[model samples]
Target: MELVFKTEDAISKLLTIKIEYFDSLQIYLLNDLWVHEMEGDFFLKEVESFKPILKRQLKYGLNPEEYINKVCKRIKEKLEFLEEHKVGSIEFLQFYCKQIKPITEITTFPSLGTDFYDEFKTSLKECKTDETDLYKFLVRFAEGNFNYTKYHEFSIGCLSYVIWNYYCALTELYRFVSTLQENAPFVDFSNLDIEDNKKCTEHLKTDIKVHFNQDKISVAHLFLFLLKEKHIVFDCKDERNNELQLKRFIEAHLTYLNINGDRVPIRSFNREFSEARASTKVQKHKQFINKFIYGLEQYRDSLKD
Candidate 1:
């Protein structure tokens, strides 16, 4: 007797596993969000949850062939379900993968594709040891209390977008490193304990923390790393911007109400948020809030100097 698996079925299965992987990441983020609210330890809370799952997955012993087969099967099922619904699972997956569209459908920054390589080269050329340069901030970010594993999840979330929206060319990632090497000594990322790093390998987790926080890093440096390695752009703003904008608007509105003696009794802030969210022109309202708050902040800052 002979055993054989159909390739299409294999792909579907893999995608299903990938979807599950994404779901696990979502759960992690949700937990982190809860922790953030409670001012709790994010990494410790996650490890408390992760160890049990890891034990269960490892119970059957190392079976790469079986594991791979199972993953492929799951992915295929998901794709089929999407196909039946007349939605490109690929397209839907792309949107979901990027943290942006899932949160709000406001803007679509075109995936950099190969142009990212050019931007990276240009950025690296302009890199200097500036304390405030965005690239420096990124390096500092890498070295800071970023929780690389969570950062990895964030990266994966971004990658889902990259795979779904941009060209699914994996080679572009490796090529990015070659480009970086052209300049100077870049981080030896191979030492990093990313998803596939073997057990007992010397991981870069501690070192990443130590170096990144020591000095302000360059945004250009960070951009190159993300673009080449992670396929994400830091300044390709989306969800974070939206949130900031909404926050600004609400603060400004409160200030105005206080000044005008409008007699609008301060009610539940949550209720107001709900109402604003329910509005048809939510984006416009959000923008209005953002602008007012930003302008007010700027005006205040200006007064000092």
Candidate 2:
């Protein structure tokens, strides 16, 4: 008898397992940081806890170079450990899964699809039965066949999907730490002249309000358009890229408004500027485009006078 399996069901189950594993791992790592007040998302909490330390070091005239190197070294050590024990072992997986809280929904399984499923299934069948308990468990769970020794032989197969999820989480954590290090010097705790800063802030706000502020055009979209039009350029030599600098400026202004009794969620920016610019090229925004062009022409006519 030929055996058939619903790949979607298997994939969905695996995806759920992966998500649960990652969620548990995040909580574990966060707890390791000894953070008491968990206010926001994982990344935000990480930044909140980490930023102050860097600031404090700089304020005290301590060399942050040694501290950053130590942190990176620790992260690298963890990465190496994770790499070595990612697969061919089920102890870590079992430990993490024990802390897994039930999730209400599983919406995203990035980079996992039909191709991944095919490769996973083929690898499972090829793995040796005595290689590890993980392989034995997977085979039994997937096929529901206890007589696997009589039915088939297994060899060491593809890296377990669960390990892939853990590796990705760790890798992102490393990148976030690296970014914080790179942007450390940009964090200013001293008082500086506010006149120029105020002008730049107001200019950005007015441009957004006048030209690009629409229900359909997000701040991210506007910034993206400006970037493409060469209205803004990222200076490679700067500690923070132009995008980060702009984001901080806009967010600071929003915070000031909020403090003055304006209720607003922080604006989010992303790389969807191309879509916004493309939308303007269509007939839907033709009138808006024409108005902008006419304004420019009027400015030129006034200059002629």
Candidate 3:
């Protein structure tokens, strides 16, 4: 985090993280994140504490009024630009999220369907992690009926002081990515400045291609599998309604990666996923993928012990 503010790309990175964090927080709100095993008061209280600390740090490191004004103004303009381009309202996005709920919900059915996202499941198996058994993790997510490892008080808590807001943002962003949103354009690239525009355009461009690496694909599959598993048990009918578990799931994954010294393949996974979302012509979805991935990359890069 200190490095982010000291680098030449500070402002760009700040804007990037700000937007990314915004998407994560918004997604958290959208999914009613607190309902998923987190104490509502505790979670909300934690989030509420971030802004003041961030503001003080920004003011200390930047021209108090100028940088503050610039950041706030840019965010407002970017959001306005998105709105003008017909990015759907939060309510609409939530509706879209709800519409996809059935695919996962059926996993809890008395007889699991034959065609239950097998491709996603296969992706998980392909990505072998020495640190943790992803197969068992995926199965745990699918079942969503067990007392899970408690990470908030441990591994996640062991992360650096700079990680609180970022952890909140990145985890929530992953939740949204797993569920996916409607196929609609989520950003307006034309209105952005050259550098930012290129950043946006690069995400949407299909001209450039890379050789698909199996490890990368496998990592993506694991994330996708975890995400789908969450949806299946995200909302339940009985006492387990909105069964809280994604946070713990992510904490466990991060712990494994940290212990094994593995670069969280989240960056590549997000790029591939972002490209796919960009292709869907949903500006809002693209905007989210881009921003969330940016923030997530920063978070992962800062994970030094």
RMSD of 2: 19.5
**Model 1 lDDT on a 0 to 1 scale:** 0.31
Top candidate by lDDT: 2
TM-score of each: 0.20, 0.33, 0.21
Q: 126-154, model 2: which lDDT tens digit per residue?
A: 76334343444446333342322321112
Each candidate structure's count of clashing pairs: 23, 5, 14
lDDT of each: 0.31, 0.38, 0.33
Name the candidate that leads on TM-score. Answer: 2
What residue runs in model 3 are displaced by over 4 Å at the alpha carbon? Answer: 1-35, 38-47, 77-91, 94-305
Which ten-residue region of model 2 has the weakest summed lDDT? Answer: 150-159
Worst window of 10 by summed lDDT in candidate 3: 153-162
Model 3 clashes, total count: 14
Shift in Å, residue 247, candidate 1 = 27
